[model samples]
Target: MPEKYHISTTPVPPRLPRIGKYGIVDWREDCARCHNCVKKACVYDRHRQESAYLRTLKYSNFLFFECMGCFYCVQNCTKELLALTINSEYENLGNQYWTPEIIQTTWQQAETASVPVSGAGYRGKFAGRGFDAMWTDMSEIVRPTRDGIHGREYISTSVDIGRKPAHLEFKEGRIVSETPEILDIPIPLILDMNPPEFTLPRLEPFILEAVRMTDIIAIVDSTKWPECLNEKQRQRMDAYLPNIAFHLNSEAPEIPKDVLRKTRMVEIPDSDDALDRRAALREAVPGIVVSIRVPLNKRGVDRAVALVDQGADVIHGVADFNGNEINVKNPRFIKDMIREIHTRLINSGARDQVTLIAGGGIALPEHMAKALLCGADVVSSYLPFMIALECRLCSDCKPGLSCPAGLEAIGFDYGVGRMRNLIAAWYLQLIELMGAMGMREARRLRGDVGRAMFFEQMEEEIFGTLFGTRKQA
Candidate 1:
């Protein structure tokens, strides 16, 4: 059997703010007192004699016991007995992304953070998007020595976020002329500004604050820098405005010299006017990098490369806003898009001179590394923030704009704190995931694409050759 996991639990106490929720196993009080019920099935045969449910009540160290909570007993009962409910008597297991059960054991130590115990237990879904869907080749799980972070094995997760020179010089040779600076970001994430309807103008302000706190960049929509910003916000904005990277329309006939002065980056949706706009914007702004954001379709990738040759330094491609691939015919999907671009860059002479950023479809923590492995330098997430703000992935943010948090209308102090906490939690989760993946630093995770296994590709490569592409046989 696989080794068990356990966490310590104290008797339910008062004054704690109820960090999380624990599930309660509620059985109908009307359970017929006389039935030699068929529901008393236990793998070890303990429940076969009946009345075994009595022992489960005062579970002091429940971690050591086997409740598996399979609900099999509930369904098999002749009396149609049993139900599960929230256990307010105990702390909750986890938060939105980290389910309650996962939080039961500290991800960092691989042991119970609260206390250590062991048992036969399983928690959470087998799969979900991003890293959860990934299995991370832990074939060596039983091998005591190869236990990634805990067993002293090396797993790398660090990544570089900005552009780099395509070529480098040798130390044996005298210094050849060094190439220009292609900026770098320590983390693989950049907060993209989607902007709230009423809180639109303050979007840049919040982004600036985020960059300040996290030491990462924020992608701002240049159009939202309206005049509604307060005096303090505007003054602070001037100091930060210089560092902020602005996303603007590359073909917008005329970009003001003043506005250009504040922006260090420009982005345009894929268009035929790429080269002309890149030149015009560069001539107007001089030191900023021009970027092209494309959907991860075949056509989009083609347009992105064409734009790159025309002097775009940043190539940003993305899948659907909901993390789905664009083309149904060649639906290798988002990561595939990154691989194609990475290979394209290696083939073209521009690989080093340009940076690649892929967004959309990054739902969970491990995806940051996955994208880099697929060859993107940086990735951004939009929906997760909405989730943090209590959006249940409802996607109505663009519709009636019925956010109760006034996320659509804010200058509120609590709003900012709440956002900070959410980001902090996400950052922590990212670090923990990277740690579990045996990746110590984010920079090392770039292009380390071999960490994941693609189900479709694996099946095609392994089964197709044998089946010889059977034609509906």
Candidate 2:
């Protein structure tokens, strides 16, 4: 058996004060001044740490809100002087979709390469919008031995990206069919290009290094080409070509034949001449896997099916950065879009012939698993990596504007380490999720809705007949 995949991670502390969810407001005037005060009983030592933080505080108004909100101190206080208050800073961290909780959790994962555990149990609603509307079945969690991450059983998270042959053809004594080349990555996650606002000259190197460390592929725009890399980087690019995928558009300059030959995969935007481009790329690099990138709009599903029928090797359905369908007011979520595409391809009897990659709004490790369950063979994410590097997701990221969080000043080592830690954390979480679902292979998890429950489906089954269709607001 091949060696098991592992990610080496070390704790990378945050650059700024942590924006945690809850803060303790101590009413010292009502304190009894007891030597054995409830504040002293803090298991996490948050009170002592808060005092230390205040002594050397860089910003006087910046309050320490790292309290875990366990309520042990609040309930134990003799005079009811201690109370937990929601941190305003935390509530304002991210937009509605990328909530403050999500940002903080991603930060913790990036720093420690471990699952985020609130000392207090889940304090959120049972179901909400987006990915929360779907839940993976964890009935198998009762079996402790099924733990893939730390148990004796090995749950494979590896997936192949390329055209798969439906069946083998043979002559009397030998095989007579040609086999397409496939790229296999240990984890079903790929690093996507950063959005225009966050794009920086130094960012590419950091992304390439992280991709190299994780042994996975990154999607790079071909138009940028060799200009994006320095001479040294260009020379070393050949070695990492297998881990790189070039994204090509009609206007992009032609890639050198030698460079194309070294790369295992290339993605072309969906167009009328996409098949012609795919053919040209294959003619240049005979074994190259060509993936068609289609926007997850109304036509996405039909377009994906057409490309598959035309002998496309892979189909990538991409949504907006926030995971919503583009150009529509009532946009469908990426999950629903993926499910539609997967089902359509299956109905067309071409699902197994091509690889499906879903991108955009893949913020968490759980999101990766959920995307797969929705029918994507793998997922791509770029924003999480930025978050890993302490990016505050400021609205204005122009060159002239001063960066609120000083992201441009980040050292390469620190940035790369944090990104690597985030990937490691995500990989561990994926393994844990697969184990709980009783799935031994990540590939099998694709389109396996039987192992998951959709809120809309349940609502229709239980409440539809009596109440009719639920009205959308």
Candidate 3:
């Protein structure tokens, strides 16, 4: 007989309920009283004695305590029974891409504010979209007894979002600054906005303040003002503008002739003569960054190359806020798009000079790490804010103030705190994820590119040539 997984050897977490009406329901319907009673013949004999449990009306015994839902009984049962079913608990982790397992895992960590465990031992599908298609490199498990967090041998998964100079010279035998190209962030997460989903002025301001206080820039579109707010709220926007970075007015960009700008960077839609246009844009407004917005798609590589050639200070590649790829055909997906652009930039020797800001498809905290493997310096997101606000993904915010998530009328302080807590939780989880991946510093992770494993590539490596053909030489 073939070996069994998820049972006999691995133990169920005691935190879960041991026995209840919820239990034994499956066993009674599926049990067969064969001589072996194959259901009783567990590999470890973990099944309880048939006579020890309460007998049921159906003439089948109920051994509620011993069944692990491992499907071992189902496999061996002559009655052809045993199945797993939903228990009517929390269903959504949000969005089709994020999946219940990932959200459940992250939320479990956030709710307890602690590390997670593989208690069920990976009860999900192996292949899917975005970061789900790639995995982190954890082959070398250097168990350091002395220092668990800062082990002797580890992987660094942190990243930075600025440029680096080629070479530096100590002018007077002292540390005179060379070219300061790179601005290193301690963590790889960035704060971005979906203003249509969040209408609170106070909430946005507080979120910006918190992020800027941590030296993390918040990406907001400032044109969402209702024109009905009091003067103080309007002023708050101006005050925060200079402090938090902005992704302003990409659809119909309007940089004033005098460039009355407060933002450190601006990510506009991709335009022709992008390089010369950026030079002119910078000339119009000094000390302001010029970024080009790239769609997160399979064509990410081509778009990135064009943007870089045009001299974009940054490339803000955004997938749909719900984490879907733009193109249906040849959907290389967002995680791979980031990696494709990163590798393209690295191969061109320009990775150190430009920032890659990837948003969209960033559903989980660990998506930040997955983004890093694809060579992004920073990752930004939105739906996490909705999830933070207890958004059930009913998708109602698009038509004016009819949001089903209740964001249209959400209280300022409560909504803001919830958003802050979500970001804060993500921050802690980011640290834990980076630490687990064997990384200590965040800046060294910029375009690190090797932090994850691509299952597609792995599949090709394992069976592509055996069953399929490689491109002709």
Overall lDDT per candidate, in order of appearance: 0.54, 0.85, 0.57
lDDT by residue (1-473, candidate 2, tens digit) is 55788988889888878878889999998789988999999998999999999989997667899998889999999999999999987787767787787888889988998988866577888898889999999888757537566756688899999988898899998878878889998999988877675653346667777888899988988877866554666788876777789998578888888888888889998999999988988887898888889988878777887888878879988888888887788988999999988998898888997899999789889999999999999999998888887676766667867865678788777887888899999999998898888888999999999989999989999999989988875
- Which clashing pairs does model 2 show? none
Candidate 3 lDDT over residue span 272-340, tens digit each: 666666677667766566667777666656987777755565888887765556765545567767777
Q: Cα lDDT for residue 43, model 1? A: 55
Ranked candidates (TM-score, high to low): 2, 3, 1
lDDT of 2 at 470: 85
Candidate 3 residue pairs that clash: 135-453, 155-438, 155-439, 156-439, 158-445, 159-442, 163-181, 163-182, 275-310, 339-374
In angstroms, how far off is 294's CA in candidate 2? 0.6
Tell me model 2's lDDT, rounded to 2 decimals: 0.85
For candidate 2, the TM-score is 0.94
The parts of candidate 3 lying over 4 Å away from their true place are: 1-93, 102-120, 139-159, 169-184, 195-203, 225-239, 250-263, 297-299, 322-324, 400-402, 447-450, 469-473
Model 3 reaches what TM-score against the true structure?
0.69
Compose the digit string of candidate 1's lDDT tens values, residues 300-348. 7777777677667787787765455675563545776677777787798
TM-score of each: 0.65, 0.94, 0.69
- At residue 238, candidate 1 shows an lDDT of 55
